[model samples]
Target: MNLLNCHQINELLSAYLENELDTTTTLTVANHLEKCLSCEKELKALTNVSNLVKTVIREADKTDLSLVARSNKINSLVKDEITSKIKATENLVLASSNDNSIKTSQNNIVKLNLRPKWSALSKKIFLSLAASVAIICLSLFTITYYATSTGPLLSGVARNHQFCSAIEISNIGWHKGYPKERLLQANNINLPKLDTLGVHFSDLHPCKVYKAPFLHMMYSKGDKQISLYYGSQEAVNKFQEKFKTITPNELYLHQESNLQIAAISTQKNNLWIVAGDLTKEEINAITSELAINSLSNTEESKLFH
Candidate 1:
């Protein structure tokens, strides 16, 4: 096989590291990397990121929840730490690699010391699922964002996402049964009758999305799961105007990027926000069934349009 250039090898480096390439392609990359110093450096960068992810996972829920740090600033701090740690490994690698003149280059050997240096890993999220699982598994972590126009709404959404991600990364909230029961017991959150609504909840936790107390419920059906939030009337209305847009129904539906969101007036006209990998119809089904049952069950006054 011909020698693979930096660009070509770069294309396959991630897959090579993940052992996703076939025998022939794998050999081609390995053989090329054995001779190509530049591509090897690039591969090391990816590996460092992976190691940082491991650090994050090890320090899960250890993030110093500053009410002020923005996501980008947190990222810069994390990268600087990685770079500093990488520097500390340079002389160690140089001392050894220099002895073996055959394959030695200016680049340092990649180390896998995943000791938690920073208070938390950066909030950056890796997107490609095929090449790496570290970043994907760790999930994105962002400081509270309350400066936006829709402060409560956006803040609530982001907090909800963070809580759900934490639960997911903890190896809970995926399977049914005892896991959900344990979470429910641990969090002491309220659980509504959702089984009749065709949505089987797996985990329930008492979470506060930017000061709005919600009983966050996680439910899975097949390959997808969603986070459903139940909050008081004031807390729900802070996100948006309520009871003004319903037509022939009592629920308001919203969505974004495969995120199905819907809010309805519950028994006390409290808010119910449902969002996740669910479809639009699925969101409507859960909200409608819940709202109808809630009304019937509580004998609450209807203020629908």
Candidate 2:
């Protein structure tokens, strides 16, 4: 077979570089390149330009260009000579010359198909990552809210108070096991007798609220019930330091539709909470009476020093 002219060879160069030509035509082109410096240089330039276009497309994420704008940019980059060369590679498949010189252009079309697909895949990956981050942040927020709001550290004790009040009779064994005398001797916290105030003590029990060991006292008069809780100064301090909500020697009131709670921080490094099914005034009076009694006891103890 005769060797094709430069013009015919030029048309087949793109197909030749992409390996889209038949075996015979591929060998013919390779043999021609051995003798022709100009055609060989042209092939090298085409490879470099094609690689450059791919690099720019891959790095599209670094820029703020829209998809259309990016596509336009790529079109511009492959314009004139480069576009003509790519177009030549595509057309080589359709060439029906007498020599059967070319193969299919499916690979070239597949490369062109990659441009938009790559951008879309990158966007989907980024969006999936963003959604995952958002979900993690939301989970963290929910955990923190419950930890501070309704967890055992804070207002959760109100639920404990309500539950204990509902079944005060079952606590008889607890009261028998931990009497008022054992409480004062062991924990150094004397339970005040509220008989003068018409709220009579019914039971005393040792219980734990989170990490704090508390002395739970049940007092009632008719339909009114009050729960008094006391914890040591050291245990209370650990809770206060971590939560930052409790302050020693301060009063905090918490009320719901059916339940009312009052928390008192005593100067002696102890915590006291009064929760009951009573009016706010009643709860306030009980807290105040306890606070005043605690103060009087502290004063009496100081007389010896």
Candidate 3:
């Protein structure tokens, strides 16, 4: 049977825990765990954590839906009322039939008064509920806006990939430590023979991803470019959960019209992402060659960057 290394073994842990891997892979992982203490600990940790999460979610699933449904009913009614009031607020003519209730015009014009003429208790309840909904919606919109603009470096990388020439290699200032030093700093291996892709190495820039410092490198190939981003675990953990986790151990590839991102986590939990607009062939070629060879063939495919 073929033995699996830590990287390949790590990817199989989730599936192995659930008994989803094929029989050969399962046996291989079991044999590997017996000899590899580090892989063994990591597997146990991940398994314990996953089981705990599953248990919590299972308990949460058992929660009575009637309670949720009742609350949702209240929110839904308020949302509808708010929607009507908002439409009414936009009308050219704003008038209220009575200060107590919401009223609408035949021609899409509606009248909404904050101080409703309804009875004292009910009126207060409606106003309070409306105010709460307003607060919730406002908060959500604010959060969404903030999240989109928060990652300027990441956003810029994504955006720049869309353009032909967003910046000169000099403008980004990639220089600093030697390639060996930068690779060491990131706890990753630099790919040899990247010249096959016509890469012009840029200086390693000191940067932050969500305020965690990491070195950034850019490689220009004519008008096209790609970025290899490194970030510590804590900072990178805040990214989309889907991107953070992967089914396969190799560099996980995600493509967009503007960019193609190949992101993976190192053994130390540091994140290394390579993004560009290369074709499937180019991406596969780059990823295949990106990692430095490990001591054994089993760990050869594990890419730190």
Candidate 4:
């Protein structure tokens, strides 16, 4: 047969082997197979290959149990390894949590221990400041109280004796008047000739007119000038008693009208006998001088005489 003619016969043979051919085609293929030795050999070889494939499938089916067992073992091992890793992570987290809790507790304890000492130091500082403030306030109060009580008495003295002049006139002939000059001659007390000690008459005031050792003495000191009737020791004592509230260590001499007279001794023994209507200003000035102790006893006698 021609090769082209064998095309259909090959299809028939393939179909016949699978039992897909009709009865007529099966007989035709069988008849052709009996006559065609090449086709018959090809069919036999295809059959033998199919049988061998079936045998291999049967063997694979039989060994499937072994494969399933090995797969199950591998799955179990992976699960165990995963669980162990999870447990190890959980233990590490627990340990870290415990350490953090312990650290926080320690910090709290340290703060608590320091709190009392800090509080005590704060209290001590506050109390010390309070005490210092209290002491300063008390001292200021005492000073103010004393100044208020004493200020008025000093002011009153200044107001009463506001008209006197502050000048010193000693052993001057013109101050004695003409008739008093005759009395000075009779007493045998030689009087100095009248001359200004560059001191003005306005600077002189009649503080006191004295007899015996000194007579008709009109004393004048700064801002105060007055004429006094200085008769006897009895008169001076009567004046002192009337002004009994005068300050101690203050030398009281005489008074003319409302004016009061006092003398203080300096270091030079000089007497600063101030007579004033403004007694406070005068006394303040005198006290300032006294602080330095400059007016001594010798200076006191020269001013007094």
Best by lDDT: 2
- Candidate 4 runs further than 4 Å off: 1-4, 66-305
The residue pairs found clashing in candidate 1 are: none
- Taking all chains together, each candidate's TM-score versus the true structure is 0.34, 0.37, 0.34, 0.21
Clashes of each: 0, 2, 6, 38
* Candidate 2, 222-252: lDDT as tens digits: 7677788777876566545544654323344
Which pairs of residues collide in model 3?
A: 99-117, 100-116, 100-117, 174-203, 174-204, 175-203
Model 1 stretches astray by more than 4 angstroms: 1-190, 196-198, 241-258, 279-281, 288-305
Candidate 2 worst ten-residue window by lDDT: 296-305
**lDDT comparing candidate 4 with the true structure:** 0.46
lDDT at position 278, candidate 2 = 65
Error of 3 at 237 (Å): 2.9
Q: Give lDDT tens digits, candidate 4, residues 91-119.
A: 65556653533333544431112134478
Prediction 4 TM-score vs. true: 0.21
> Residue 125 in candidate 2 has what lDDT?
97
Among all windows of ten consecutive residues in candidate 3, which has the lowest summed lDDT? 162-171
